[model samples]
Target: MMKAKTRKPKAKSKGKETPKQIAKKLEGIGDGMVADIKKGKDPSFKTQLRGRSNVEFDEDRGILTLGDKETTRNFLNIGHARKFMQTTMVAAKTRDYLNQNKTASIREVYYELKHTVPNSKENTFDGQTESDAVIVDLEHSVNTIREKLNLHANPKGTLYGDITLKDKMHHNDKFNCAKLGRGGWSVMSRLEPEEIEIVSVNAKYVLVIETEAMYERLVEEQFAKKNHCILVSTGGQAARGTRRLINRLNSEKKLPVIVFTDGDPYGWYIYSVIKQGSMALAAHSQYLACPEAQYVGMTLHDVETYGLENVTERMKDGDIKRAKEMLEYPWFKNKLWQNQLKKAIREKIRIEQQALANKSLEFVATEYLPKKIKEKDFLP
Candidate 1:
């Protein structure tokens, strides 16, 4: 019985091999098996049982799976795979530099890496291979890293560097006239809104005229006495100083503003500046343009409606061309421009605010300003 009680056969250790390990061993044994198969030698029974049919062979499926799938492919055998890895490492280092410098470009990264690699090979991979495959792989890796890290491409080459929307807003707030006064006017120099003096403020409304000539005429004509609104002249294009002053008037004084301008494109753009900041500049959009201000104008329609046909001047070819081009602009293609352009095409004329001066100081002072104030329609 003791002799029969031999140690129970050692339990077979069913330790399972990982897919990666299995793949490696299969790859190692595959070359010899494939050579044997090529030589027309029948695989041994044991090899056959083990499913070894050829070198570098796939047992589960006959399909070749090598040098393609990134996760499975060996970097040494596949040029693209090796390049991809190298590019990834370079991109990581570049990203680190970008985090510190914040103004690195693709070209800069390429040159920097090229300098670090031996022989200063600009296009070649490790100075041995000349293939765009590596550069392409590097670009792909950089893009992937950018997506994963939520990093923005530094395309602008800005001085403060790659800034976010929040950064822009923060910078805008710092430069705000309300915060820094007219002394910080440099920030808003780009907007170019008219400058007007805050002559008086009662409560009802704010009146802004486009040109200084109009302001002088209104004052000389005694229009200020009739209309109780605060009068200010956006002294042409609304300069930086003017914008700062307007900001103070609107925010601190809390006055609802109305713009009076000529019916031409330039005047329309000026009125737009007071209402919805100018598009030409980038920084002053948020601070200078008051979204709430309304436009009250000397429009093309007023030329006909007011029986001022004699005052209407012939439209220049330049004016017509500009009007047509306005159709392509986002804001100008609306009903406002459509009506204006149709009138311009039909009448073949353009009207200026100065033409309204002929209506006599009494007519303009009494009828014109009152009608605009009541109707709340900025454009004629």
Candidate 2:
């Protein structure tokens, strides 16, 4: 049996590799291609093939990770030539970003590299998708994240609660999420330890809410302040940045993570992605997934226990299909999850977090959440 890889706790300020160090790695890749050309061999770029088929769920660790499958982009092959060229261009531009100590969004990187090819009418890249794919290719090949290469995606999600952090890279600002009031601190896309520092946490646990409306309701009720927990709003499916922040908080601060979502397959899946890592970005799961996270709300049982069936929506065909699919996933193989999935499929009913408002606006913040958490009521 293959032994599972054990990850170490990340240091509070494990700064990223310097620009020169990253450029050296990029240069090695270029040098290899040059040596291949000198030896009259086909120059190829090899990287782990990304997607569902090339990923494996590590049951012990509860994270989807890249499997051993790999694909090569060979320069001599007609089909692979275009991609190979695009990948080379992306690597060179990323080296530039590193050497210049500059940062850019994925979109910015695409535009910066887009131009007419010399002595040809064809453009270097047709769209951002091509560049984006190559960037990920570089990431897996180099065994580093894009943030180290001074690249980032657009930021999403919001955080509110009793946490204080410092931004060392830009403006050197230190702020507390609690003091930010209603707006809360925007979770930055580049939340790597080097950029953001977690100074102190005055919370018992972190509550990640799936919807913005529900998050707002809790905030209005001063849920975080009263319960002494950090509140994170994913808005919908969590972006990579949001997940990473949650992972860091859970791992570094040693705080428990509790997820609240609608009582439906889609919402449950969102919680799953947060806890076990998604296949699309599985390569970086060690730094992103929070395996310790537990589902806290919107269960089918809650629909009955809280008298919420009156406000529950009938499940759609897609929802039922998703629920059935979850029953087979290794991570969802537990009896608790199996019963929930079976019940969801049989009942064909889904409840939203907002349905708690049927009782009262403050019901969730004051009663439902407190009671559930106190009783250690959670779905594995």
Candidate 3:
């Protein structure tokens, strides 16, 4: 009997993978499965299982990461066959999209691939959820993001700053965020370096706000101009694009990131997701998480110091429950957060970023932020 030759997987690129690269990786998976079948082996592949149990927070790196808990999905296994088939279908569709230089939403991919299996009554996909899960599986299997495969989620978040951006993949136009009027530049879902270029930055720091209302207030007050900083609004929780932009501005442009959010457990969780990574997306934390980011406001301590106690809202059961749960998180186990959570749970109260309006609309942009930054008063 002759020994079979073994092949090592190719090394992935440092940042974003090109469409060609993505297509090659997709093909590699198919080829590997074919090779396995020909070699009299199970046609199977492994993917890191994702969930709370499989996520670990790296103390040194200050980011969440997926642990080495991989599960093999075999084409011959009944439990894994549906998902394996779905995953391959998604990969095939994604490769077609890449070859044609076309982009589609995850929803579009689901619809495009939805059909009744040949000689079978079962549908390839019952809904978008099944297809969406398989897309993520294919991403993990290929060691690349869906964006690289010519797919994207809905775009969210906004940015207003004295920065210029070049859209190399689309318009090939250079535009300044400052001149975009009050609406600001809509942060697109695909901000991969190859797609969008951060041409120039003339800012000192980046202010990531949790809400759009606060973002608009800062823009209206010319906060970015006066402070010489960038204003990024995550809408609510920071999306992958917003987080990646924040990471790029901090790491590449040498700008410090400060997050401002409502003084509630949910809002603080948003800040945590920005500064640290979330369990769901831990695999891409190095690309999306800004661990160096600081939290600068809406702290429970701020209510009394700033005389905004009257505006504080009573904490609901959910808020109190969340606050307690956060205390157990390794990242949130610091002295500052310890005091904040204990106080919030004890006091049964929460506050919003908008509560600062009691002082004045410009107070946050002018007084609060400047004082905090100057004193280096930020929670870890």
How well is each residue in 153-241 modelled by candidate 2, as lDDT tens digits? 88889999889999998798999999987989999888988789999999999999999999899999999989999999998899878
User: Candidates ranked by TM-score, best first?
Assistant: 3, 2, 1
> What's each prediction's clash count?
14, 0, 0
RMSD of 1: 23.9
TM-score of 1: 0.46
* Alpha-carbon TM-score of each model against the true structure: 0.46, 0.93, 0.94
List runs of model 3 lying over 4 Å from the truth: 1-16
Give the residue spans of candidate 1 off by over 4 A: 1-200
Candidate 3's residue-wise lDDT over 1-380, tens digit each?
11112233233343466688789888888899999999999899778897787787777778877666788899999998999899888887898888999889889998899999999999999999999888777777777777777788888999998999999977798999999999999999888788899999999999999999999999998989998999999999887788889988987898999999999999999999998788778777777888999999899899989999799999999989999999888888789999999999999999999999999988998899889988999999
Question: Model 2 TM-score?
Answer: 0.93
Candidate 2 achieves a global lDDT of 0.88
Assess each prediction's global lDDT (C-alpha) against the native.
Answer: 0.47, 0.88, 0.87
Please identify model 2 stretches exceeding 4 Å from their true place: 1-16
Worst 10 residues of 2 by lDDT: 1-10
User: What lDDT does candidate 1 reach at residue 317?
Assistant: 83
